[model samples]
Target: MASPDGNHRHPETNGEAKPPAPKKQKLSTSITDSEIQSEFSHHDASVARINNGSFGSCPQSIISAQQRWQLRFLRQPDSFYFNDLKAGILESREFIRSLINADDVSEVSIVDNATTAAAVVLQQIAWGFTEGRFQKGDVAVMLHYAYGAVKKSMEAYVTRAGGRVVEVQLPFPVSSKEEIITEFRRALERGKENGQRIRLAVIDHVTSMPSVVIPVKELVKICREEDVDQVFVDAAHGIGCVDVDVKEIGADFYTSNLHKWFFSPPSVAFLYCRRSAKLSDLHHPVVSHEYGNGLAIESAWIGTRDYSAQLVVPSVLEFVNRFEGGIEGIKKRNHEQVVRMGEMLAKSWGTQLGCPPDMCSSMVMIGLPWCLGITSERDTLKLRVHLRDRFAVEVPIYYRAPKEGEVDPVTGYARISHQVYNKVEDYERFRDAINKLVGDKFTCASLSA
Candidate 1:
């Protein structure tokens, strides 16, 4: 069933047990660009699966490894849980620790996803409110563009404790990093002026909709300067998409979804706590047998759940190394691909990029042509479905209402993501679809929005 040391091991049987199979070999140098889709062969070839940033695609080999783990668990549930699960999780944590350059292995814990991690952190802070470490009217800060789930967690946990949430209205179509820093500082200063004590600040490593890379380290410094008590970085799009060194960022808590960019299976992510973080107060959202144990132990077995995804981490690492320069090289290549495609689409549509190239990672936002008449946020849903169902293009479309002193009342954008499997023809198909839609005088009225 499960291996104590986390290596794949078949359960003993009547002289028929087998050793774990060797890892799949890396792609040959002779593999062509057209053949790259074979690596993730399970994905639909007819539709252009460009939205890799949403939920990452796993290689076939890694999928096989995970299936093997699942079979082992099914073969002997008791042995797997009592013996193999803990060590397997520990092994996964070590891999993530090295990947993100965490300060210590004890500081890293695996959660179901970024949302669960957010709940864990917010729950700790909420308990602090109960314990008098924080008082009512204390504030927790987040960005206007933070993930919806994270914002909800804050509202549920923080507000229940009589704490307040302040959303920093981060500027979209941002011109430079300075604009973001200035806006964030202004938000903190405004809170202070209102006689509020800022207890926590949540920073997005890379925003989801209208996707852009945030200057997290600089923002954390701003939090310190403002005397904010703690910093939690919600880097749902961080791990494989950007350079994430939790130690370098200097945040109290950081979380990123391996399923989003690190090519792991769904529902796998890592939460990192600084060595100086208040571990005593930090606990998983769900309390179990290991309640009083550390976050690692408490999070390890959250009661009868599939641990196969976390167990497949080593296979994921092996799959990643198959690429030319490992994760770093893969990120660089993806950045270039997405940027080039974004520019091409922008040029074709007579529009511009939402942010400068430097502000993007593997995903880039290209402004949708005004001719499409996507005038409000409500139109995004209908138009997005239209693109997917009719045009067979899968990319996220975002709509922004006009800000003060802006000319346009509405703006729409398409955020495109590039992965190893994506090719030029995928983006070309998107460009052509949008162009055709514009030529046909597509409008919000047509969408009945």
Candidate 2:
């Protein structure tokens, strides 16, 4: 039998199948950096990939496992679909449930990504609004910096259904966690003062553009106190970036992308719907034969698609265990390396970090030197293209227009991501590339021309 980690394991001896062995714990000591980098030799060594946060790079072993599954499907579609797919998905969910400390396997459903999960939850809530469970002008609170897709999802479903969206304007380059908590609380209270009942709150585990770790758990607790009807955590960068204990957080619904930081293939994420939430009202955005059934069954078969990524969760978990302290150790190493690299870049550019070290996870947002003339989102995009095409450096450039009462009129940042395969030289390459561009007097206008 093919094992999750691309190894072969004998499941039968003397024509009798053996019981599956329990997964072993992670090793205490991790492999060397060179050895880790060797796992992704398939990638282009010429390009410095420092944007692992956007779309994670899978290792060759996991790719082999996925290809094996694909070949198995192609060999005999009937046997693969009838006998293998459902079991494989359930097995994947079981592993993820344990990883997130979810109370039951039923609470977790595998979907393409966090966007689909958001649609599932928001559509259900929209249905609730239609049924008169919520009044017109009911508010759905979200941070001003929530993922763009998620905000669009809420606007489409909630706002169009007689509900309203209220944004909590979180301070950028924030000084402390207390500031975030205070702002969140104030948003909820201010909405209530305006006679708008805050029906829901969408919180991020980590902000994408600015790449700071949010105090989601504390925010959830505040939601409970504020009597917000429901809370959904868009933790797209959650699973491998930090220790996510879903049950401990006690949010009504939470979704995270396994592909972002969990070493899974692209387009696979898990949504956790608390058993106590309105499960009967929730349904998959794509209606399948299992529509009336629970979300786990409904989401499992969302019309014939690439199910290989979802099936390889066991293999992903196995790959994670190969490192020391498992995901915990990986996160620790990534955080330390990313912070050091971020500081290095800030010093090299004569700029500063967007937030403190503790406010970040495996990614950090470092201020780009203002001399580069990155003044707007368009400028950030142009500079990003220039960096990728000219210097073969892949990093995210973000621009934050100054909000009211801010010191700086314009702010630009480079959000750098760190993963197991990354080394100091990769970030140094980025730093040197930016320095050269600045030294060469390249500006956003020059790139545009």
- Please count the clashing residue pairs in each candidate, in the order shown: 0, 0
Q: Give the TM-score of candidate 2.
A: 0.93
With a 3 Å backbone cut-off (N, CA, C), the pairs that clash in candidate 2 are none
Model 1's TM-score against the true structure:
0.92
Q: Ten consecutive residues with minimal summed lDDT in candidate 2?
A: 11-20
TM-score leader: 2
Q: What is the C-alpha RMSD of each candidate to the true structure, in Å?
A: 4.6, 3.8
lDDT of 1 by residue, 1-449 (tens): 43532555444232122323334346666435555567777899899988998888887777778888888789999977766677677767877888888756788889999999999889888987888987788889898999989888998999989898888888878899999888898889776776879988999999999798999999998888878888999999998899999878989999999988888988799899887745557888889988867787788888987888998887788777777777888899999989999999999988899899999999999998876777677888889889899989998889987667966433899989998888899999999998899888888668754
Candidate 2: lDDT over CA atoms? 0.85
In model 2, the runs with Cα more than 4 Å from the true position are 1-22, 25-34, 403-410
Which residues of candidate 1, in runs, are more than 4 Å off? 1-35, 403-410
lDDT of 2 by residue, 5-121 (tens): 544434232212333433655566666667677778988999999999999889888888898888888888887767667767776787888889887777889999999999998
Model 2 / residue 247 / CA error / Å: 1.8
